[model samples]
Target: MAISSAVQGVSTAKRQRFLRSTVVLHAAAAVTGLVMVLYLLAHMYGNYKVFSGQVAFDGYSHYLRTMGEPLLPRTGALWIIRVVLLASVLIHMYAVIALWRRMRKATAGKGGRRYQSRKNPRGVQRTYSSFTMRWGGIIIFLFVIYHILHLTVNAIAPGGASESPYERVVNGFSIWWVVATYVIAMLALGFHLRHGFWSALASLGANTSPARRRLFNQTATVLAVVITVGFLIPPVAILFRGVGS
Candidate 1:
């Protein structure tokens, strides 16, 4: 009785602490996600300007750099947002890693008790979402890193990357192979978002009831389509129409 009581007490204490930390981390992720979504939307719009030609695309980038420049010389708005985004991504990764390790430990501790009984744990399964949880996240993380390096860091982009965003995109996409790579990555992003977008709402408390969950799922679907199409437009335009003067 005493051992069980002690274990119960410890469990409750740990639960309380875990909840507190999760609440803090989740709030940070949600807020930063919304902010990052805004930046991504703006970026998609700017890239979409490729329809008009390189000048229009590059001009849009210049406007982004110089917007509220001398007045807000800190460039604080954009850089600050980027920093927050980085932090949020770190926190998100840590949370998942921590949870994953805990689950792994728990699985190891099971001692094959169920397996020994020959009850098919494999046959009796959970939802599709449960199956994809581990690998899907890793895939998305890899893709996000590639995305940041390709555009944000301007490292992997084509010639004149820093001097001209338009040229970087055109030269990169004109290769055909590079555009195919992006298309593949975006298709993966579409899959990741299929589950993630709705799940995020549940975490953020938007999916309170069954009806709310349905609405949240619909909203997530729409947002996912918007994001996928918005990103694909610029590359499609560049493929059909030649780039630059």
Candidate 2:
């Protein structure tokens, strides 16, 4: 009796610790995701500069590299931003893995088989989002790598990347498949953002009231659409040769 009681006590304590850890991790991931969303919005606006002509667009790129002027070295501010974003990505991934493990353990602990069919609206939304998220994340991740390779490094340029950043963008989008892939990736990003933004707010405890929940949902939807359209415009315009002189 004493041995079993002691074991139970220890297990209970461990469970409590796990719950607290999960909460903290979820909150951290939510905050990091929010930061990334803000960055995406700013990046989308910068991308829109392509419509102003090559000089304006390339000047914007140069400004990013020399942001802080004499107070910071060349690319110093950009590097700082990169490091912060990298840290956020690591933390967010760790939190995701931890929460997933915890959820699996919980399901197994209930003595249920792998397949149980329960149909509820919220549950269905969750199921759909979870299914889409894994693949959507992979797509977005690959797109990011390809985007950096195509534009930033000028390594795989189809029409050649000259000294001008504007030329690289135009050259890349000039390819039919490139624009198609970009559009597809942006669609995936839109889906991911639609679910992720709302969930992040929920994780941060911002949906306590019905009014707040409504506002959060609306904001998330608006943001997702805005970002998707904002990013798609420049690529589509470049592909069609519809923008700039």
Candidate 3:
């Protein structure tokens, strides 16, 4: 009997350790995801410069490269930001996988909904944002890779790797297929952000008060819409405005 009790105690301790680690991972992912959201807002702002004219847009791109010039070499600040974002992405993905595994383990024998919120007494149905999160994330991730290749590296430039940032953007959006792809990707991004932003706030302990919770949800919705429209405007404008004339 004593030996059996000891084994049970050890198992409980192991479970506790696992739970603690999962909590830490969840917190880290929430924080990093919020950072990425802020970065996207800044990126969208930069994209809006396209409306000002080719010279303004190109100058904005150039300014990003020389942001911390002299004290830091050209593109130094940009590389630093890239490194930070890359690390955040890796960490965020790791945390997501770990939490997902834990969730699966917990629900192994429970054959009901895999993602229902048990905290709600009414047993409310999941929102579209939550329902589409995983697939939306996949779509956005694939889109980002294609976007970087198409614009950043010129691996698939429409007009043969133009030197002008404005030209590359205009050239890419000139294609109907590219504009269509961008619209789909932006829609996915909007849905992802809608859920992700509010969830991040909850994870960070901002949902304690009813008012705070409502504000967080509203802010998340606004952010999702603003970013989605801001990003879509450039490509849509270029497509309809005639790329060079």
Most accurate candidate by TM-score: 3
Which pairs clash inside model 1?
none
- Assess the local accuracy of residue 102 in candidate 3 as a C-alpha lDDT between 0 and 100: 76
Q: Write the per-residue lDDT of candidate 2 for residues 38-140, one digit (tens) a residue.
A: 8898899899889888999999999999999799999999999989887887887788767767777988844223433455533333535545866888898
State the lDDT of candidate 3 residue by residue for 80-136, as single tens digits: 999999998888888877777777788794422633466755554667998788799
lDDT of 1 by residue, 65-102 (tens): 66676777645566766687777777666765665566
Candidates in order, TM-scores: namely 0.73, 0.84, 0.85
lDDT of each: 0.67, 0.84, 0.86
Clashes of 3: 0
Which candidate number maximizes lDDT? Answer: 3
Give the better candidate number (1 or 2) by TM-score: 2
| Weakest lDDT window of 10 consecutive positions for candidate 1 | 109-118
Candidate 3 weakest lDDT stretch, 10 residues: 109-118
Full candidate order by TM-score, most accurate first = 3, 2, 1
Cα deviation in Å at residue 230, candidate 1? 1.6
Q: Which stretches of candidate 3 lie over 4 Å from their true place?
A: 1-20, 109-124
